[model samples]
Target: MGLLVGLVLTVIGFFLSVLAFVLWIWMLIDCLKNEPSVGNDKIIWALVIIFLNGIGALIYYLVRRPERIKQTGQ
Candidate 1:
């Protein structure tokens, strides 16, 4: 029973790590591509994402990302 529990925990840990890595990469790319409207420069945001890891990406998404608009044609 203990062995099976250990294996399951290990698999869960591995999956979480992979998810974090993907989120980090996606946020890094998005940060690089978008220009910040109010906060620091692009280089700074990029560095934050690189150094602070997943937390930095979460911060960027919550604090810095711009609002989207819908365009209408007449």
Candidate 2:
């Protein structure tokens, strides 16, 4: 039972670490993207994601950046 619990916890821990890594990579990618001439919002979001990690990425991707990019057509 203890071994099983440890294995489950280990898997959970691994997934969490992977999640953090993915968020950082996504932020780095966002940072590298060229900003649209019409807007600074995506660039701002990229910085926010870089600073705030997962939560920032979530908000930037879900709330702010999509509309901005759509408006820019880039």
Report the number of clashing residue pairs per model: 0, 0
* Candidate 2 lDDT tens digits, 1-74: 99999999999999998997797777557645744535775567677887888877777668656675676664
My TM-score estimates for the predictions, one after another, are 0.78, 0.69
Candidate with the greatest TM-score versus the true structure? 1
How many pairs of residues collide in model 2?
0
Against the true structure, candidate 2 reaches a TM-score of 0.69
Assess each prediction's global lDDT (C-alpha) against the native. Answer: 0.77, 0.72
Q: Residue 10 in model 2: shift from native, Å?
A: 1.6
Off by over 4 Å in 1: 36-40, 66-74
